[model samples]
Target chain A: MKMIAAQALVKALEHEEVTTVFGYPGAANAPIYDALSKSTIKHILTRHEQGAAHAASGYARVTRKVGVCMATSGPGATNLITGIATAYMDSIPLIAITGQVSSEMIGRDVFQEVDITGATAPFCKHNYLIKSAKDIPKVIREAFHIASTGRPGPVLIDVPIDLQLEEIDFQYSKGPDIRGYKPTYKGHALQIKKIVEAIAESARPVICAGGGVITSNATAELTELVEGLGIPVATTLMGIGAIPVPHPLCLGMLGSHGVRAANLAVAKSDLLIVIGARAGDRATGQTDKFARQAKIVHIDIDPAEIGKNLGTNIPVVGDAKIILQQLLNYVDEHYKEKHYKTQWISTITQWKNAKPTNNIKEDGNNEQYVNPKYALSVLSEVTKGETIVVTEVGQNQIWAANYYQTVYPGGFLTSGGLGTMGYGLPAAIGAKVGSPEKTVIAIAGDGSFQMSMQELGTMKQWDIHIKIILFNNYRLGMVRELQKMKYQMNYFAVTLEGSPDFVKLASAYDIPGEKITNNSKVKEALDRALSYQGPYLLEFIVDPEESTL
Target chain B: MAKHTLSVLVENHAGVLSRVAGLFSRRGFNIDSLAVGVTEDPNVSRMTIVVDGDDYTVEQVTKQLNKLIDVIKIRQLNPSDSVARELALIKVTANSSTRPEIIQIVDIFRAKIVDVSKNTLTIEMTGVADKIAAFEEMLKQFGIKEMVRTGMIAIERGNQVIKIGSSEESE
Candidate 1:
């Protein structure tokens, strides 16, 4: 009838139906690890705490469950900060547990003691510092609840070792009675009716979807609403797979370097319906100029994001899935046979035909090296738009966003908000672990790949099937491109010199890899890597001067 | 930008104050004055916060605070429709010569001498910020020794009430 807090935490994790966890063990976390060793949960030991965090996020993004990660106190907890911020910015539901010093030594600055709760307060949706063993059950339950609910975000828990050592008469328990924390799910009926009426009345209407659509898993509802009204859909980077990429009415991504057609359609549309999007600077170039002709309707769960950057004619604060479902229902009941004009569709199609957005040609001395765009196109062709494509930030992410086709929601995972360079490699590992049947790939730049390449060891250890499509341009190409465009072609410190021999590095980890150059070699190398049974790497010799255009 | 007065109801729990303060400080929103005390329900506490910001900033602050689990409700108290007051204690340098003068001043201001010493007379008063400011301005001529003031606390003028309703379920 009685147990230690460490054992109780494991029980809580089991009760929540968590099958996998990513973490590292240390002195402060010895008790928890001891109990974890006896539990049935599969624990992934990552090389760095950051990898543990990103891997957890990747797993969460794919499974839509609260991904759990752990680390010891002080340095280990500090290392998880970037990963926590990345997940927070992306609205991923995660449970990050960190070991703490004994309660008596918390403020005394003893060995491995740090105020992790204070450090993570601003980013995490909620955090707790466990002072008593009896509070562990309720804390874990509330942690999971707060993590996966309305607008999902990361939550943190810091358990002092002394508390974990305390034995109490603990029984398996339910969650806390939190009366003040209620989230509005279903939107107002009047607002739904108004939105439906607006869609019905508009001639040139466009639907813009964001990461919130994927988080809410409302891709089906969004398709029904937009396609029913014959409205073309333009997505942000995070909303890449909100609907099938090849759908006829899709304008693809719209923003700073978006598809020309998507941007043009949004600029010309009369009514713009923004669903689960914050309209960031990258997504909305020149806020004053963005969708100037459109009367926008913004729907999101977070009230702060409603009018953050742009003004909205109608702001609906509720879950995207619930609101989209209501809108679809209203449309079915009131105007089931309603048809919108095809004039706007014809105009967008003309733009799409004038220049295929995915077309990338080998230009400027391309005989020896692969064009980055060409490599991505081969990736798109080989994967058939059906694989999980996790991309690191910079030119690589932009290229993948430009060319890759997504077949399903949550198909593309990228660090859009925080834009951490080391995100892709570890996240792909997590994604693969979360779904073993699916093919997972980390499309990364050379500079970004090395940032978290330690995860390559984790992959070897776990025997996961993840293909790494390394675009080795031998430099940080995105920053170089920015400098070329803005600073009179002056480049300094952005180039990657003294970098490790990547193929040799992978081989050392027993991960077989092939070095690729020339546009013709890309398809064959990717095919070979993708066909490999276990983890494999393909390093592409991309032209250093190639920009993302 | 203009000054705003908001009354926040929060669950009486540890870390609630730190969470609220952390949010405001992290976002660079300056708090002019803050006062907290338990409400009629021992389970909940009331906080009056004054900040200077524009409409958009206030909306952002309100939305962010609402995201916290411990926060129950937030209502901006309108000056014209609310009765607000603050309590302050002031100690003035006093002697036999100025003792009679200070007593006359306290009588006129409706203040009471809570403590008296050889070189000082400590007076306590409860009133709106403007009234307290006027009293201090006049008493400063006699050379004040020390002073402490509680931030503003408010209630609606009449039958209009702001209630913190606890929902029974989440989602």
Candidate 2:
């Protein structure tokens, strides 16, 4: 049937079963907006293009589908750059559709014309510039396929406004037939066998899980593997919810700022099974010293990630879900006997038990400021470990990563790879929108909160119920801490002295909120926010001297 | 670091070159030289990238290239089992007195004089990089003017081949 390219694109979205799209409209994309107005897919208008992209990422994480975001050309497309980079760093599956100047004006530097495909090519998994209206369905199909496949990341499709307004005989395309793109899903049988044998031989075996575990939806398989073999699991920050944080065998996050026991366990391990993780520098300090005694068995879908950061003795290239399942089958056949890791587990337990206590006093806390760690622990307790906690970057992120116990898999979200400060609030909105029944919270520091605080208006407009916990430390806490450690406390631009009153700011959006200072009020304030059926903000006055550790 | 030549088969697309080049620069992998051209199949293009790195770097280079959606296959040619060649155009300062000597040197290197001016002789040479470098050295005494080279391209010896859906034994 002959129809405008914009109509066909919306139809293609429906074909892909896309229910919602986060976007900001502009003249360049007006035709697309007009077509979308008649479609069933819900459209969310974010305050900014970057917010739309981040919200899409959050939605993708929660829904386990390709998140879709849209923007016009020029500055609208440029605004999505940071969000796209953030998604790329974390391997989030996102499809960013952008409008362009008319095809005739493409290279003429016309109004609202920017080479978005070129701008985002370095980061996105793949991108396309649609030249023909007939290719919309094909490009859309390929974009979705590329975005959600092995080592999933963002993909871009830049459609010119002229093409959007053109009529075409559109026939819906079949499955992706890109000859150059085939992802290996099943691991090599011999490699899987080798991993099982290595696990059997080693006395001190540890499994380090990364974000890939959650991405592949293999948390249940991972949890079973851990329990079936009695192997302790240490997670990267991105792998926070791979296994329940409170599980007995779960070692809290491991790395530079990771828990002490996890680091010690990794140091002493004889065999390390690294799965679904790139093991970036943030997760592995001084590569040569990382897991020095361990023979690393790396399993990742992307062959490039196998030994890019750390040396691998046994490398299995395939999907994590399939490979973990393969390992589980082998375990069922050969590892029915009792685990030989009892002594090793005991040693790790000893190390975990002997870990030092926090420096904060256990008695009546200072009346002027609430301890961030203590407040987070209380937040975890109040929520019964069931809430979906998304954190902004810096001290608040680290505290939440360390203290919050995620009882369910896929419950923690953050900008792990990019460390984007303004991610939490928008991501919380996405998560809440995707899973309305689940309690969603955005934990932010005073500095990171203001980075995308305009998203508050988005929440009020959409009526998204997200309980925001703002940690008002009045400083860029993470950078300030770094200066304290490495620069002799020569602080310069790290302070946020002119920050607005967050509680009053929320009230401006008609979102009820209150500010609390004493440690005694943390639970009450958190409870009040959680029980409220609408968007609520609770601000805590955190000590500026508080350290991430 | 040892230098390794990787022949990658990719889809014939406009931005594929940029994708491959961008990946190298962003990942901090140094590319010594790169030569690309249409293959036997017009729809597929081949990129011969010479990367200077150790075993770890070579492995990373190959795997990262394979990650690009445009790339169909990658084959790292073994020096002993591959025929490598590079084409160079050298403009030598040729006066009537030095013309005979320059022609003799070019003849010895099995090169051809593609273009000639009163003051210069532009000689074309196609051989391995070492051979081209040696030929350039032979003409150095005659005062070479300018030179340009199409970086190295290679093919496997005998029936051994790199193609779509072929076994990765070559890699």
Candidate 3:
């Protein structure tokens, strides 16, 4: 059957089980929108192209599926850059579709014509500019395949407007088999055996988990491995949800902003079994000092990351979920009778007691001034079951990292590597779209929220009732804090000039919002906000002098 | 810092070079020389990258190159056992009096006079990067007008072929 190329794109999405897409339409992408309108898939019309890309990334990060987003030519495609780069830095699987000028006009620099695939080439995992209408089906399939496999990142497809209008003989079942792109899922048996021997010999073994564990959906395997061996698990910021923070063997996030206990766990260990984590600078502090005492065994799908940051004694390159299972099997077969170290557990317990993960002491005795940490702690408590907490970068993000107890996999979503501001709101919107059954919250700061406050228009447009929790400190608190510590208190442009009344801002969107003044009223306000369904916003007036540790 | 030459086999694609270059930049390693060419297999491209660093840099660059989806294989060319060549074109500002001296330098280096203007002589030479640099340096005495260097390319001295299947040897 002959069908419009744009319609074939939509059918391809349907074949991939893409139930939702976040995008903004323009003249170049009008044909795609025309086709989208006829499909059962929900199309979210975001206020900005950036929001659409970010929302798609958020959905991908949460669901482990290739999230799809679309945009028009030129500025629209340029706007998607930051979001695409953000996803790329964090290794989130995303498919970004951008409309181009007519094929004849692409290089002519016609109005709204930009080589998006070329522009995004440096950052994206792969990119393509569709040359013919006949290639649409296979190209779309290839885009999805490349986006979701082999340590996933964003893949872009640039469709010229003329190509969208062109008709093609439809064959929905046909897909491209990428011969060169085979991702290794199984670990070498020799490597697994070596790890088992290393584990048996190790008196103080620490499991360092990163986002790859979560990316591979290996949370259960990771938890079981740690539990069975009676080993303490320390997580990178991206690996926050791999194990419950409250668990005894679980050390909280490690590195600069990470708790001392987790950092100490890595530093003191005789054997560091690093799984899925890239061992970034922030996570390692000083590279030489990071797990120097340990025989580091790095496991990741990307072989490049194995010895990138720290020296690896044994490198296992494969899918984390499968490798973890294989290692678990090896451990069970050989070390079933072996007993885990008691002294190691006791030492970890001492460290845990020394530096507790959740001690939010209310320093502000005043009824009006709210402590950000205390506010976040209470908010964490009031929100009951199956809540996905997404946070903007900086102090609010760190505070959330410290206070929020992630009990489930994919429960916590934040921009880890890029540390991009204005990520939370759009990401929360995407997360909510992906998992409509769960309660999603976007935790933002006074500075970060305004960066993409325009996204409130998207929330209002879709009637997306995502709980917006803004920690209003009236300043770029993290920057100010950094200046005070690093630059001898020479404060410059960190303060927010004439802060917007977020309550009124939400009101402008016709959503119920409130400003919390007192720490005592945080719970009541959060309770009220969480109860009223459709996009309630709450602003916590946090102490400006106070900063996240 | 030790200088190492790496032979990287990659899928022939537009963005593969950019990704390889980007990875080096992100890691703060500068490429001393880079030469890319299509292999016998049209789908494969051979990249001869000369990087400057210690053992760590070679390890980092090799491992990172392998990780890229486009990169198929990588081999470090041992300078003693490999044939490396670089091409350089030099345009010298030569007059009737100075032409003989420039020609003498070219003849000594086995270089070719590719182009000539009334006042300029363009000489082309192929050798190891060091020899090309020396040839260019000698030509500079006659006031060189313009110059270009094609980074370095290498092949093993023996019968071993650098193909798609060669990467399995690393494993």
Prediction 3 TM-score vs. true: 0.93
Q: Mark the 10 consecutive residues where model 1 chain A has the least summed lDDT.
A: A332-341
Can you tell me which runs of candidate 1 are displaced by over 4 Å?
A333-339, A359-365, B95-99, B159-161, B166-171
Q: What local distance difference test score does each model get?
A: 0.88, 0.90, 0.87
Q: CA lDDT of B42 in candidate 1?
A: 99
- Please compute DockQ, using alpha carbons, for every candidate against the native two-chain complex: 0.69, 0.79, 0.42
Worst ten in a row by lDDT for model 2 chain A: A355-364
- Chain A alone, model 3, TM-score? 0.97
Measured on C-alpha atoms, candidate 2 has an lDDT of: 0.90
Task: Write model 3 residue lDDT over B47-160, tens digit each, in one string.
Answer: 999999998888888876776667877889889989999898889899999999889988999999999889999999999977887887787778988889889999988766
Candidate No. with top lDDT: 2
Q: List each model's interface RMSD.
A: 1.2, 1.0, 2.6
lDDT for each residue of candidate 2 in B1-171, tens digit (9 for 90 to 100): 888999999999888999999899988999989999999999999999999999988998888888788999988899999999999999999999999999998899899999999999999999998899899899999998899999999999988888687565644
Instruction: Put the candidates in DockQ order, highest first.
Output: 2, 1, 3
| Candidate order (lDDT) | 2, 1, 3
- Per-chain TM-score (chain B), model 2: 0.96
How high is each candidate's TM-score?
A: 0.96, 0.98, 0.93
